[model samples]
Target: MRLLKQLGTVAGVALAGNLAVGAAGGGWVASLVLGIATGLLALLAYRWVVRRTERRRPVEVELAGARAGLGAGLLVGTAMFVGVIGAIALLGGYRVEGWGSLTGAAGLLGVAVASGVTEELLFRGVLFRVIEERAGTWVSLGFTAALFGAMHLVNPHASLWGAIAIAVEAGVMLAAAYAATRSLWLPIGLHIGWNFAQSGIFGTEVSGADTAMGLLHGVTSGPVALSGGAFGPEASVVAVLAGAAAAAVFLRLAHQRGRIVARRSRALATATV
Candidate 1:
């Protein structure tokens, strides 16, 4: 019940924010403003709901470490995508055609910000964190990662392989990031950086969703396995490999920090003895 309340509250705000963004129309300025507003509201909602339900400070969103975490995450996320694109280009998969629309990129920035903040709050802040407290880190990571991929199946260009790629690359990697830092800011920044770099900077379709032209007129060719086809490079083999490598690093950090949670049964048994 407590979990449901927290989830419902945060999800509701996020949904409302999406709708608001849509209603904001085609203007990049409006979209950007609303997007930032929505993100702030979502954060406040999460904080408020967690306080009311758990009666404790939501350390995952504590402001003290927010700037540092977000900065590090953004840097890592942006560099990762750039590296992936570079690798694909080396294989003759991606190329730059010309300049793209600044307006389109600005609008995408709004979408990226809104989605990044809300998704992290909903997935890592609520679902993964709550579940990890009971089921253990591994179980929570697996379940949430699969569910996250499944959710993206509704996208226009979604494919079984794409969903699997998302599950492995984004879902697991993002969760591991959260686990390592125990903060939402890092994953939130990562999500924004990746999405914006995909569509806003690189002008690639995000999660198979059709988007307006971004900052660079970028194009991809070659096989689907290499270029990610219509679903974009997020589904490419290189992306999965890169994400897996990053996930391994974050998981190692989490383990070293003693943040990995034992299953509830094992914890109970240990306590009993």
Candidate 2:
């Protein structure tokens, strides 16, 4: 009932946004603008649905703790991406070729920003939150993380291993961030920073998509495990290990905050009462 309506609202709004933006067919700039607008609209829709179905206050969807989440997310995201890439470079697996086009890097930032806001709104804000209410933390986390990774199968040069890497690295990590803070802003900032640094700053392929020229043009050469092969640095072993470590940290924070929901038995007991 309520769950279905909320899900429908999210899906419907997302579909509408995609159609509207895709049909407009402006170059990267127009697409970025439309994508961001759609993300805002989706957030509004989520707030509306949640208010109606769950009786949450307006502040929950507004600026409540947004600043902290944004700051934490940005710092963590930048450090994680830089750390992974830096490790590869230090190992002599990656080398800088030359400078890249500033304009190209800017263009990629727009894309990353659009992707960050929109995906966070859809995945963490709407889907994960809604599902968490019904399914509890671990179930919601696993389901949404798997779906997030599975959705990437349609990317330009996607592979099974790439998807798996994304599932463990990004999907779980971002969800855990949300679990830790119970806010979308952190995950949104984290997503934006990670992607921007990966493609825009480091000038690498992002999730198998060709990137605009980056700030630092470089070539990666090493074993597939270390170099990330054709799927870019995101598929590298360093990324996986770093992401797992980050998830553990956030999970600990979530546990400390009493934010991690217990299993269904406990949840059902509360519902029964």
Candidate 3:
């Protein structure tokens, strides 16, 4: 099946890149780099397969979508960051950890961008689209979203609750990213910005990995029940709800543009034909 081949591509890319960079001991960095590239390649391969099968030119990644998504994402991310601080303060879990350097900020920014670009392309772009052809859109989206969230369970401090929260919250964000212009950039921007703000800027744990630098350094004070423990802020209910709500807004807007069902249905029809 094409989908199975797509999965094969995923594994191949990961293996190839890892082998190439392993000699240099890139470790997580190398593995991540390979993984991201693998994801992008998978997306490209999917695009090629779908376009050929449907007799459509593969849709280019949209610049306009990327720009617009970036703007909307920044605004939304900023608002959420502000809100999280308020929530933290209200819960009496706030602390100020001096200052994080500009270099550190830049590094975090790099991390956000790389991680976002790689992840969105893999999960939202390749896997989502590939599965959508055989499965329906809803099935593809929900399955990929849940898979994406569950994949994080391997993180240092992930919990069952955290996995669930990540699945739902991050799932929403991932969907919105794909829906916003159907280009994948919006979700990438939203994802990168949200994670950067949550981890680097706020100094909160990002899915259990200790952020190396940012504006504020915050340690979780409340029980793991509220704070998400080592799994970072993603495990928190607040983050889950926030991501879902933002995604819902994107979905509503996309539906109005008549972009939701038509293209996907067309793709399905072509795939079957």
Number of the top candidate by TM-score? 1
Comparing 1 and 3 by TM-score, which wins? 1
Give residue 69's error in model 2 in angstroms. Answer: 1.2
Considering lDDT, where higher is better, how would the candidates rank from best to worst?
A: 1, 2, 3
lDDT of 1 by residue, 1-273 (tens): 888998899889888877887786757887778888889999999999999988999999999999999999899999999999999999999999999999889988988998999999989999999888888999999999999999999998899999999999999999999999999999999999999999999999899987888999999899999999999999899999999999999999999999999888876756754
Q: Looking at candidate 2, what is the lDDT of residue 104? A: 66
* Number of backbone collisions per candidate: 0, 0, 4
On the 0 to 100 scale, the lDDT of residue 38 in model 1 is 83
TM-score of 3: 0.77
Q: Which stretches of candidate 2 lie over 4 Å from their true place?
A: 1-28, 58-60, 266-273
User: Model 3, poorest ten-residue lDDT window?
Assistant: 26-35
lDDT of 1 at 142: 100
The C-alpha lDDT values of all candidates are 0.92, 0.81, 0.66
What lDDT tens digits, residue by residue, belong to model 3 across residues 1-273?
A: 555554555455545544655574544455445545654654466566655555665453544455776677666666775686567557766566577655555556655655666566667766877666556566776888889888888888777788788777777567755765677766766777777787668777777777666777666767665566677667766677777787787778767776464334666677775
Give the CA lDDT, 0 to 100, for residue 34 in model 1. Answer: 84
Which has the better lDDT: candidate 2, or candidate 3? 2
Q: lDDT of candidate 2 vs native?
A: 0.81
